[model samples]
Target chain A: MSDLRLEEINSIHFDVLKEIANIGAGNATTALSKLLDAKVDMHVPNIEFMEFKDLAEAIGGAENVVVGILLTLDTGIDGMMMFILESDSAEKIVNSLMGRTCGSLDEFSEMDLSALQEIGNIIAGSYLSAISTFTNMTITSSVPYLSIDMAGAILSVPAIEFGKISDKALMIESEFGDKDTIINGYFILIPTLEAFELIFSSLGLM
Target chain B: MGTVIKVGMADLNVCKAPDALTTLGLGSCVGICLWDSVAKIAGMAHVMLPDSTQIRNNDNIAKFADTGIKETLDRVLKLGAQKSRLVAKIAGGAQMFAFGSNNDMLRVGDRNVAASKEMLKKLGIRLVAEDTGLNFGRTIVFYPENGNLVITAVGKPSKTI
Candidate 1:
């Protein structure tokens, strides 16, 4: 298999990435719906090769406060996956899970944080499992690390990882939310350059 | 009131008295602010990595702490800032997420902060103040007129150094 650069990624490659994102996010959305016991809607996944500076703009702005759950792909792929939600959305999810009306995100207790982390773990597991099954790759993820910070700060982890190799990063982003409360959560997947080549060759696209 | 000039990630810029330099959402990346109070000139660089020499694609000088600080200093000097009167204040370099594993990539924040201070010392610039190496991200604005570096973080009080 030939090495693939971010700049050299063509429409066909994007289509495959999108399909992977679709399968992964579709499973995640289903898992979310089951957990929440409510119908959830997911937007078509967007695969974009973005500069490090523009990564934060995907969720609104750099300084926008967000709750981020990050996990490293330990096997089969060398990269990371992130589940990001706006502060209010995270609060809403925690409230829904615990069946309590937690007025604000600022007042999240330790239990609330743990609940959020568990939600992240479940959703991320479902997403990865779907991708692993579809591509026949044994993908395993590290324990989720949770953080509440600015979108820019949270995204910097993956951006720095990508920056080591290139100025731009290729991300597969999917947005899923509840219909009533409109709790929008973003799922971002960033595979390393070598992982991209492996994925393409696994599917005989290279 | 000065206009806020935004410095993007892995980027640098210089401005005068009435214009301030700002960079948003610095996580594991350091924002270096260099000022010549007498000249009322300021420069800011948002560096992503610790060293440029260690990487093969080192063309983007503004992407590393060592090179980024030097380039920012050069730009400010060209804008009439005196090198002898230059002082530096830095913010950002946060470990946004904590993990048990001892991966070097996760320690980029500390490395960036250390590299930045080393570069400032090598350039003969006095390191006056800093807010770094915490588990939170920071957004910083640098004003040359007063040499104040204002740092703001989520769920934390904003401070000026």
Candidate 2:
């Protein structure tokens, strides 16, 4: 077997991430459509691999973000994807789900948090599952962790962990819907070094 | 002279004698260390989450609060140090997330600190000091040579634990 190197492995990992996100976006669109009772068009705009710091900056335009991670049993086989949305967009998603035009924090119910977690769970899990299928790997995901906070704290995470694993990271930006309820998502894919090697070797692409 | 082994989230750094171990910018996370002043041996860990409940068979044992702390303690003991001589000092548990003033669920940082203290007590370890809670990031330095815990917070001077 040839030497297992990062450059050889990362390309394959990036491709798998893109294809999975492409398929998963369809799942997200369908779920949102059903939830909102309207057609929500979701598009995966860009898929690029960059450093964790760069991915953080790209998602910085938003005020509020929904961050989630989907980890598999395989140590290196985890994927993390976060949704960055302006606070207004997040409020809109909640309002639309609650069937209200505007609602205060007191008016907001636990149902709203559940609704947001459900959306994040579906999108993050679907993306990881789709990627696992393409890679011919069996992976399981934990219930997604949902947090809504300022962009800074959300962005600071990858810098500590993900950046140490890969020189550059895989990312996809998706835009969905056309109504006042436009939803945009930034999907990131960062595989550990061992997982990166396994994908390429398994695909016979190394 | 103490050697400082700086650790980060989900990471652990170990050092022996004349060494001071440390972890910085700990917020909503826990920093743990087991040090033997007489033996001048120590181990430090910075864990982001509370438990292994989120994952299974996660060999990265340093990513959780109780497991990481216990692992560090074991290592410090293995370095020719007796368990009775081991002492613990912890810092960091800042509420980094800004939420509604009434939102209790946002107290992840506070929860982490409380959980760590309780776990240590259960383990029969003496916590000589702790600088936790509040809303500021912390830089922790563990001096193994003298069992000195130097804790420095943002906008605050360094103080011994």
Candidate 3:
């Protein structure tokens, strides 16, 4: 077996990712429109690719880190989009939406569990599908995993603690909806050097 | 007199006497607090999203909206709050995201608000007062004794809900 040559590998540019994001976002918008029976609006305020260290700084003060699944659906789109949110933010989002007094996670009951997972699955799944089409890549996603405080663990990695995957970070802040119901989705997309190359090459801009 | 309960996000703290129920940082999220002044019983929940189907759990409670509300209500009832006398006060659910962009995902916050309202309706609890929607975050405090609610918002004025 011959070793894969770096020369033969393809990589994606930041611009390519941005374009893909635009397309993926459009797909997500269309999906939302059909679901809510209302016009869906969205925004991608900032997008950039950086190292892992930079990604950590962006997370700033996240008490508990939630790393959702790295999932792939048969919906046809490729590429991967992972959903990571601070545990506090996740709880807050659920609590506020239900119109109940905000309490700790210990207060949640059986019904709440089903609701959160359903929403998480839909948003994360749809978002990734859009990214795949925009990038024109066939990337595989794993079943989304819920990593409780994984960020802390990741940061604690011996190499990361000293700084290893410092430059594999990408961040995007997206907002949607009207005056009555506004939602913001903050996404941090990080890719390894290998993955990065594959993405750019797949888009033919590498 | 009734007991008042106050709940915080990710944590639960309740009192069975005349007290206050409060929740903060509600954006597209809901603050549901039930109070029975005569019984001096109160229960509060600060939910950030609408449901919890996405969250897989092995018995850890207070993480989802539907279960969060039900649990809080049940706790209050256990504290001697009669369902008929329970009055609901709500605040939060501001549209934190702006419109007119290219990326369009489901607005989790909005769906949350709608879900909360439906749940309340199903519970047969009359919402005495509510402060929801718009594009901002809110901090709500409820005094069960007199049915007083003080809602303070960031970058906005504090008003009673």
Q: DockQ of every model listed?
A: 0.83, 0.05, 0.01
Runs in model 1 deviating more than 4 A are none
TM-score of chain A of each: 0.92, 0.79, 0.63
TM-score of 1: 0.95
Residue range B6-73, candidate 1, lDDT tens digits: 99989999999889999999998999999998899999999999899988678899999999999999
10 residues in a row with least lDDT, candidate 3 chain B: B97-106
Clashing pairs in 1: none
- CA deviation > 4 Å runs, candidate 3: A1-206, B1-6, B10-13, B54-60, B99-106
Q: What is the interface RMSD of each candidate, in Å?
A: 0.9, 8.2, 14.1
- Locate the minimum summed-lDDT window of 10 residues in model 1 chain B: B98-107
Best by TM-score: 1
Q: How would you order the candidates by lDDT, starting with the best? A: 1, 2, 3
Task: State the TM-score, rounded to 2 decimals, of chain A in model 3.
Answer: 0.63
Candidate 2 chain A minimal-lDDT segment of 10 residues: A62-71
Model 3 per-residue lDDT tens digits across residues B1-161: 44434354433444555667665444445677788879877777766546666443213245445776778788888888899998887776554434324322225546656777777788888788888766555667777666777877533577985
lDDT of 3 by residue, A19-90 (tens): 766666566566655655667687764575544334434555212334332232323332234554555655
Backbone clash count for every predicted candidate, in the order shown: 0, 5, 91
The local lDDT score (0 to 100) that residue A87 gets in candidate 3 is 53
**Candidate 3 TM-score to native:** 0.45
